[model samples]
Structure formats: structure tokens, C-alpha cells
Target: NREPQLELLKNFQKELTNYKENLEKVEDVDSYKKDVSFPKICKTNDDKRKHLAELFEKELRDKFREHSPTKTIYTRTNQI
Candidate 1:
């Protein structure tokens, strides 16, 4: 029915909006990475562990964002 279809469209719009908001939050991650220091030359074990943690967190944030479903949908759609 039209009513059900309309409800579905509304929910889709809401999801799209949420995705856009998430995109905004992640947009600065690239610049943040550029300015971040990597402990590549750390001498101590503790320093090495800390650098590894930073690297892991950085990679996790950037890589996890690559699988955004909304982004995939946007990429696949053909706009007129």
C-alpha cells in the first residue's frame, strides 16, 4: 500500500541523514592523521607498545569507515 511505502521512504531518509552525520564526524580523520606523530623510532618496549596502540587505533578508525553502507549505496546509484 502507499502508506507502507511512504513509511519506508521516511525511514530510508532518516538512515541517510544519520549516515551523513557520521560522514561529517569522520571527514576530519584524514587531516588528524596527517598531524599525528607516529612513534616509529621508539627505543623502549613501553614506547613501542604506545606507538602500536596509536597505529592500531588510527588504522581501525580509517579502515572501519571505508565500509559505510550508505557510501556504497551512494556510489552505486545513478543520478539523473
Candidate 2:
């Protein structure tokens, strides 16, 4: 009968409510945005590319250098 379907819907609603409550309890929702600080002035396309490259290199070094010292790190940029 429809009784099983009704019960399933009720359970789904309860779980959705619990999920919303947990999401609202999160304090640092935008904390990821605060982690990276980008340069304010990128006058030309080359400047922007250089800044992004430096940022990528710094992130890679910070994350993987300790784990793999012997591994070589390489970065490539696409030509426009």
C-alpha cells in the first residue's frame, strides 16, 4: 500500500532536516576563501600568468615537498 511510501517520505524529511541543522552549525563556512591571498595588481596578461604560476608553485611545494623530496616538480602554462 501507500503506507510504506509515506514512511519513506517521512524518513527522508527527517534526514533532510538534520542535514540542514548541521550545515547551519558550521561557523567557518568561508574559511577556504581566507586561506589564499592573491596579488592586487596584475597590470598585464603576463603579470597575471606569472602570479598564478608562483601561487601554484608555492602550493605544490608546501603540500608535496616533504612527502617526495626526490620527485621533480614541473609546471606548464598553455599558450593563448
Using all chains and alpha carbons, the TM-scores for the candidates as numbered come to 0.34, 0.36
Q: At residue 13, what lDDT does model 2 achieve? A: 56
Q: Judge candidate 1 at residue 23 and give its lDDT.
A: 41
Estimate, for each residue in 1-80, the C-alpha lDDT of model 1 and write its tens digit.
35654565565556555644454455334343465555557655445445545565555444433544354554556352
Instruction: Rate residue 2 of model 1 by lDDT.
Output: 59
Q: After superposition, how far is residue 48 of candidate 2 from its true place, in Å?
A: 28
**For each candidate, what is the lDDT?**
0.50, 0.48
Model 1 scores what on Cα lDDT?
0.50
Residue by residue across 1-80, what tens digits does model 2's lDDT show? Answer: 55654565565556555644554555543342356454767655445445545555555444443344333442222122
Clashes of each: 0, 0
Candidate 2: where are CA atoms >4 Å away?
A: 30-80
Error of 2 at 22 (Å): 0.7
